[model samples]
Target: MEGEINRSVHPIFTRDPEDFMQYLNKQVSVLKEDGKEVTGWVYTIDPVSESFVLLSFTDDKTQLDIVMGPSVRQVSVLDENSETYKKRIEAMFRPPEVEALSEEELEKRKNVLKSWLLKNRLPVQVAGNNGELLSISDALFIEPPYGVENCRSTNEIILGRIQGLIKNMPSDQEEWC
Candidate 1:
């Protein structure tokens, strides 16, 4: 009977990492075997087992819940988080301890940040021998120029958009190129 219910809901347990990645940092409704619903922002998905970790925040405190891979009946993404909410989530989950950085580490981080800024074509000004800063507007609008390259098939356009979205996601750890 439970197996029947799970099959009826959705086969979420067998989904791939990319499929599960779509729910990350977004509010979702998870239907359980007993017909109860749990809703929260998806924190992470276990790539090996495909289980889900959800986080719920209240005025007084925050709560974290884990739903086993086989027990997840169905998942429906509810809403996307705003930039402020994304920052809050990142800060909340950041490691509690702050380690003193060595000069080598500081130099490496600065180089990475500079490379990222240059790749994005953001206006940057060198501040000193070892550091740089950039002044940005509260909102910057960019209008993509339409051309033959922009006129792609629906499927192609959608794939490109998805790839771009994935590329723009924040990484907690440093990625070496």
Candidate 2:
């Protein structure tokens, strides 16, 4: 609702991804070509297809609606529900909790990963203020525990390769460390 649009206009189909970002977590009323109106909180918009996903919440259930780009006649902001709806959307997709590992066990896992990377002849280094990060490349770093999920990289190719390598790492490889 920050950049509220008043008039009935259809620019959503041609709107840039940046424009869609503003609608995220905001209550919106989308007018379709057939006169059907959809009102919900904006969850996501597909950059490629321009289709947007909306979430409608009730006391006991949440409903999801995806509106196609071409069918949308107009999209107007109704209100901002960023704080409440954002948490709900996140919770909907949040992964289950995992058991916490002790600091010593976490350190050992990190060391094992570093050793494995070394064995594979991949460049690796300790980075970050507290030396808690494993730097693999300019755009890539693996957080503590050194698991695939902890790997972060701007480059998708590099990220995928590193995560795949870690996933396929032989069990005996840990014994070598």
Candidate 3:
């Protein structure tokens, strides 16, 4: 009932190194003429079969027959069950939380927000005072790394405490995070 859906969308790539790109223009023209063009959204294009894709926003599950450079292939569709679909959608790009990551997950709350709200926002790299790349890798490594931190100043205090806890670690260990 729950699994990744990698529906094929026709036009998959082929192994012929020499004839690979020969059918490209024709394929595009066909898809366009048929009004079956890929909708404007991000879909994972298969490297070998450029036609195959994992489309996430279709209205329903169905296979598409696509004419590729010089051939046609049937791509299969694997729709996730509703429950699994909802969960996957929810977990997509979430990152670990700092104060809470110390535990496990942390639901985003109304009170919790980004720190960038109160602080000055700047680009990742402009010349630092030294005119060199000011690697904000620290911000990158810290939980909630970079941008403005959410939570109260107390959350910062907690983060500082965690940092203190790591103070005694060996330099090699400390180099991490």
Candidate 4:
């Protein structure tokens, strides 16, 4: 009975990733196993998981839906022309622009962060190739720019504390770069 239901849903379950590549960027109608229907533009389909990321746009807001492979019974392309949502979709997940800092400026930031950590009574040492990484008690490690996001650790409590410290630490510059 289960296999019969799957067969009735759609052959998409057995189809290859390349078979669904044609649906990318096009508006599509997805029929679910439970008989629910969803219509949206195809952002991407995970080649591994076979899940679909769908995009829906309103006047000022854009919504995203992730449909699992197993839940998707069938997928039908609604629009073939890609020009409409192509640019908007590309811009949706684009990283925000940031000014590039010079080697000297990066080094200065690193030094300031190390000093701040030491002042906080947290042991910190410069490590990594070209002394680019900061090792905190050989536990947490921080990469360049030395912001809280650069922190890496398995200990969630220490990581949160370190991130908090970085966030509240006073900066010499007017803008806490």
Predicted structure with the largest TM-score when compared to the true one: 2
lDDT of 3 by residue, 65-169 (tens): 333422323332233233434333323434544333432122122112112211224222322322222222234222232222421133555455434433433
How do the residues 64-90 of candidate 4 rate in per-residue lDDT, one tens digit apiece? 999998898999989999778986886
**Per-prediction RMSD in angstroms?**
15.3, 10.0, 17.0, 10.2
Model 2 gets an lDDT of 0.81
- Please give the lDDT score for candidate 4: 0.82
Mark the regions of model 3 whose C-alpha exceeds 4 Å error after superposition.
1-43, 46-113, 123-177
**Which whole-number lDDT from 0 to 100 does residue 108 have in model 1?**
61
Q: Where in model 1 is the C-alpha error above 4 Å? A: 1-15, 82-84, 97-177
Ranking by lDDT: 4, 2, 1, 3
For candidate 2, the C-alpha RMSD (Å) to the true structure equals 10.0
lDDT digits (tens) for residues 30-144 of candidate 2: 9999999999999888876678799999999999999998888899999975776776785576343212555577678878999888888899998984586899866789986
Taking all chains together, each candidate's TM-score versus the true structure is: 0.48, 0.56, 0.20, 0.48
Q: After best superposition, candidate 2 residue 173: deviation in angstroms?
A: 17
lDDT value, residue 163 of candidate 1: 37
lDDT of 1 by residue, 1-177 (tens): 555544353444555558877887889889988888888888788876567888888899878888887778999988976342554565575433212334465456445544554566655333422242221121211111111121223365544643353245345423422
lDDT of 1 at 64: 86
Better-scoring candidate (TM-score), 3 or 4? 4
Which of the two candidates, 2 or 4, achieves a greater lDDT against the reference?
4
